[model samples]
Target chain A: MARARSEERRAEIVRAALEVIAERGYRGASLGAVAERVGLTQQGLLHYFPTKEALLVAVLEERDRWDTSGGRDRERWRLDLMESLVEYNAMRPGIVQTFSALLGESVTEDHPARAFFTERYTQVRENMAEVLRAEFGDELPGGLTPERVAPLLTAVMDGLQYQWLLDPDAVDMGASFRDFLALLREDSKRSA
Target chain B: MARARSEERRAEIVRAALEVIAERGYRGASLGAVAERVGLTQQGLLHYFPTKEALLVAVLEERDRWDTSGGRDRERWRLDLMESLVEYNAMRPGIVQTFSALLGESVTEDHPARAFFTERYTQVRENMAEVLRAEFGDELPGGLTPERVAPLLTAVMDGLQYQWLLDPDAVDMGASFRDFLALLREDSKRSA
Candidate 1:
């Protein structure tokens, strides 16, 4: 019961932090605002989070948990399912904004989240390569290696997000992503 | 001569602001830090830029001016020239980091730069579509309209930068972009 209660409190705190960050941005957000939402003093929050950077880290990890924690098979997403992931992302603009905001901010000089993103991209690339390998074998029909193609796949998904966020009505994130998948298939027709 | 001197002073301040934003990030960057870099008091800097938001807008516009302000025809870039542009971007990681960092942060709530990026992307997409229409004529071999494909081209460029920033050595930005260019051509081959 004690352990479960601690986990629940942590979850509430993370949710509160996300709301604050989403509203005020990471730089504008205050630990006080987050703690207040959860009915704790800033010092009390620090007992759990230790530092502002630690809280940021926890928020990012929790986001990934929400994204990938759907179930066991969710981790091993296929190409088609990846398209669905994009579709799912379209439904939740607020969450997508927060995640993208974090990603964009974290890439700069000595950001606490920079290392986290670097490692995540590394793993994401490796996982994408495996997905390509399983579906298309060692090399795609056009003789491109799975390792080589994985990054492009990742890039399109990310690139479309920026465009979609800027103008959702103009750029249908899911349809555009499907179009990209169609383009990917165009290569095989020529090679075959 | 006095007007020219003032223009030069503004340029110097903008450059200083860029360096500070790059090093400290946009969120962490301050007018005081920027002023200190260019030998101005905070009050003096305010005389030039009435607000921090104005300074940020000036920084972003300066970046575009550096990119597209090369002359008259620089604005009307062709598809092949775009490849050169990508190559050019690869050589300037600091500028790219600053631009991307701002872009990511601006996507969230009430960022001063959000409207700037939204308008810029609107212009960028329309420009990209024109480039595609000129080269491929309405649509490429895949029958995908230029309007539909414009976002993908932009997405590829933006997406690749994030990957390259995270791990430059592991991902050769230029070569991968060339590969994407090659993929774009694959569709034409089938249609032709």
Candidate 2:
């Protein structure tokens, strides 16, 4: 019963964190404010998650937790899964705004989330390379090595987010992403 | 004497605003804190700029004020000029951090700069389409119209910035961007 109650409480806190991040962005969000929203003191919140970063990770993880498919093998992030996530973000305007704001916030100096994102990108880059290598062997179409194309994949994903967030009607992430993927495969059929 | 004094005072305030933004980011920065830095109250700060957003615009304008070439025609943002700006940003990590932070904060709801960035991107898309049309004619090298390719141009530039800012050592913005440009011209030679 205690375990169930704790799980329930954690869920509530994650919801509040999402709202807080949506309101003030990840950098602007504070553990105290989130705690207050959940009827817990800062100390009480700390009991659940040791630091703001931990809580933020929980909130971020929660975003992916309920998705169609995430963390399938932990290390190997499939391309289709990424496409689905982009589609999911398109449906959720609030989450798109919140995550975009968080990425923007993390680029600054000494931001609490700065380290988190920098490390996240590094990991993302490697995972992308791994995924590309797995699917395309050593090289993708046009002799573009997996290592060379990994950053472009992530860049297109994130860059499209900024544009989509600014104007949804003008740029469609799902469609635009498919077009990009098509560009990569433009030479693949010729080679095959 | 009064004109000179006011100009000098504005310069001081812009400098202070830069420091504040570096420390606190654009959203976290307060006009009051900025005024206090230059030994003035909020009212005095308002007298100079009227609103926080206006001050921020002024501060942002100040960033481009001393650039080698900006606002050449006010409406036309040249591709090479943008490339130069990327190189310049690499030289100034402080400026990159501040601007990247600003963009992040602007994507959220009701942020003072949110409207500005939204409008800016709308304008950027148009400008890019115009630039692409001017260089590539109505149809680009691979049957991709400027209208279709405009977002990709902006996407790659902005996306690379995110990657570059996250890890400078691994990604070279200047080199990577030129490569992207090369990819665009890939089909031009064949058609010609």
Candidate 3:
């Protein structure tokens, strides 16, 4: 029961952090506000994560944790990635916004999420490209390296989120992504 | 000569505003600091753009104007677009960062730049697709639409900018964009 309660508190802190950071941005968000959101004292919140940066890292991890558990079926990764994107955009527009603000600042060689984002982008792109390679076989053109295409895929996802965050109707992640995939396939043939 | 001096002052104010906003964000940047940067009184700064919003709008418009005139040759639009992107990522990183922050807030139904961004995205997408259509002949397999393709182009450009801003070396915009163009050509070939 103690361990379970601790887990609950951690989750609570992460949720509160997301709400606070979303509203206040990375620079403005404070432990006091997050604690207040959770009905805990600042000191109490510190028990879970000693520093604000830790809490931020935790919050991002929690978001990705939920994303990781989702889309279990490898066969439908494309569809699943698209669906997860829509759900993520709906559930936490602020997180996306905060990310857009912090993205440049966070890319330093020492930034906490640098490794995570780099690896995450790599893995997701390889997965998507492999699916394409398998579907089309050798006829699938030559130079379509996963490294080459992954950035485009990742960029579309990130860019579409920005657009959707602005005018939800102006950007359609799933449709746009599917169209890109189709276009990618077509482009592969043209170069063949 | 008086009008030329006034235009120069306006440019100075805009430059000062961009630096202040980059350091302090849209909210933290104040008229006083901007005025000080430009060696003008607050009233003088206000003479050009009366409100913060007006100043921001002017900054965004200036960015648009810069984009329109800077290295954007019409003959080889694709190469021009690619080189322009590389130059932008190198020279005006602050503009990209500020634009990301403002983009979220500006997309409301009635923000001053709402129509501007909306039309800008639409027009840019169409223009890009026309270039692709011209290169690939109007019909391509998978029944791809230019409307669909254009947004993807913008998404990749916008998204890649965010990533590159974070980690300058994460993806090479010129190389990746060039690769995308190659992919587009390959995809145009069909199974034959």
Local distance difference test scores for all models:
0.79, 0.74, 0.67
The fraction of reference interface contacts (C-alpha pairs within 8 A across chains A and B) present in each candidate is 0.58, 0.46, 0.40
Candidate 3 stretches with Cα past 4 Å from truth are A1-7, A16-37, A42-57, A70-142, A187-192, B1-8, B15-34, B42-57, B70-80, B104-119, B187-192
Error of 2 at B170 (Å): 2.6
Candidate 3 TM-score versus the reference: 0.72
Arranged by DockQ with the best first, the candidates are 1, 2, 3
The digit string of per-residue lDDT tens for model 2 on B19-77 reads 88767665556899999999999999888878777677667668755652445564446
Q: Against the hidden true structure, what lDDT does model 1 obtain?
A: 0.79
lDDT of 3 by residue, B3-62 (tens): 999898888888888888767665556788888888888898889878776777678778
Candidate closer to the true structure by DockQ (higher is better), 1 or 3:
1
Please compute DockQ, using alpha carbons, for every candidate against the native two-chain complex: 0.53, 0.42, 0.28
lDDT minimum window of 10 residues, candidate 3 chain A: A100-109
Off by over 4 Å in 2: A1-12, A15-43, A49-54, A64-76, A135-143, A189-192, B1-12, B15-43, B50-54, B62-78, B189-192
lDDT of 2 by residue, A26-122 (tens): 4567899999999999999999988886787677668755652445665437777777778977877666666677777777656677776777778
In candidate 2 the C-alpha lDDT for residue A126 amounts to: 86
Worst 10 residues of 2 chain A by lDDT: A67-76
lDDT of 1 by residue, B88-159 (tens): 888777767777777897786677888998998898888888888887787653457888888888888888
lDDT of 2 at B92: 67
For the candidates in turn, chain A alone yields TM-scores of: 0.81, 0.76, 0.70
Error of 3 at A181 (Å): 1.2
